[model samples]
Target chain A: MKKTIDTSGQACPKPVLMTKDALVENIDELVVVVDNPAAKENVSRFATKQGHTIKNIKDVGTKFEITILKGGNKEETEISAEEFNCAVLPSKGKTIFLSKNKVGEGDDELGQNLMKAFIYSLIEVKNTPSTIVFMNSAVRLCVEGAEALPNLQKLAESGVEMLVCGTCLNFFGIAEKLRVGNVSNMYDIATLLTSENTLTI
Target chain B: MEIVITFKLTHNAMKAKRKVLFDKLSAEIIPTPREISKECGFSLLFHDSTSEDVRDYLDTNELKFSKIYLRAVVEGERKYEENN
Candidate 1:
């Protein structure tokens, strides 16, 4: 009644898809083993969406064993084509790291303009990042007078978590001027950057 | 409702922003909306209440602007209309 699928070294929906295939084989329970965090999360989310309950998730060193219990009427389990779209996957471990007030090298004015345009475009994008971490000069963007404050505020209002480095704020002498985001420390920032898929700008 | 003022040059837009901030006017410099054409890539956004004051300030300051638009919220969507 229990089936084991070792999806080690497999990518993305492959693990989720293989698990789905096993779920329909009249099995009462399924154990999916994935090596990467992304695969584990994908498989777990897929199982949950298909009306299967996760009984347990055990982490053994680099691997994870996710045990899922088949819900009632397994024959009725169906995931619509729209639901299977990868773009609809939850953004659980995505982070954007902003280290400077400007976006790129070259003329300071143009860099600043590019940074503003980047943040504005990010807000309009379909897939919003889960979190945006500001450090060093980038903390200025979250402060009162910075040009990008409004866009940062809009992003915050849309459920994007913002973390402004406390040390950097104090260094810039603008700690009190921070108008958005939670004050964070180096430790928390490092942990987030290491754990999540970070896009540095 | 929101109002956006776009300038013909980035320099003029930055100057207008500094003046607005210095005068304690509630305005923010944001990326110019794609629907509007202006030489400057950035625009100033503020509440509709300050529209006339902003216009007067820019006029008195000799800040050359391309256009001004009023952004209204209609049934959860934003609609922009040219004011000048």
Candidate 2:
């Protein structure tokens, strides 16, 4: 009997593991379906490396279905699952999360000054972070009269998305003084932080 | 055009920054670009349009700085030529 294993929407290692488990069960024939190119490539490579023969590979729209025949050395098929690495590509530029107006601990004035320098440096970089989210006192950097305003404006103009926490703005009583970036809520901020690679400062 | 003022020390750079803003000039404290000088870690960046006023103000307040430069972007690379 041919067993079908659906690994669509699943990242690497998971799909590879499912295929490996089915192969380990001594299944004569099996079909592995994957939704992404990475998963498809990884599963196919894993099957072939395990000494199994790939009977057919059918590209079904955005997904791929791979049929494998178990006819290899059992010792080779016994390779550990951890041996397979997941090659998930970074989807986009990183997200910078600024929770405070300063960059580090110690002297408040010095930290503030350093923070300004940090923002200024970003304008010089070739590849800037895709998004910069400001929360708490960090929101002050986006308001009017802020020393970092112009730098932030330049970054925003250069296609970097800026998300300033609205709750933090109102709490600081500077919501109306925002000179750059959009006022964002917690939900949007949370989504960016979790969905993208985030660097908190 | 942009004017950059490098300082002998980071504190001096920070102090000069405060003085410029106090004098109603928009200035920012930035790490001194290697093109300017590798010694000073901090510098003040502002518009070249305010060069004369900024220079006069710094001299008036006795804010000693290392050097001044006119920052230019040549071929997408920052070039700092001595303006003083």
Number of the predicted model whose DockQ against the real structure is largest: 2
Q: Per-residue lDDT tens digits of candidate 2, residues B1-66?
A: 688888887788888888887877766788888776666488888875556766787899999888
Which portions of model 2 show Cα errors greater than 4 Å? Answer: A1-91, B50-54
lDDT of each: 0.83, 0.85
Which docking class does model 2 fall in? medium
C-alpha-based local distance difference test score of model 2: 0.85
Interface DockQ per candidate? 0.36, 0.71
Task: Find the candidate with the highest lDDT and give its number.
Answer: 2
Q: What is the interface RMSD of each candidate, in Å?
A: 2.5, 0.8
Worst 10 residues of 2 chain A by lDDT: A76-85
TM-scores of the models, in the order given: 0.61, 0.66
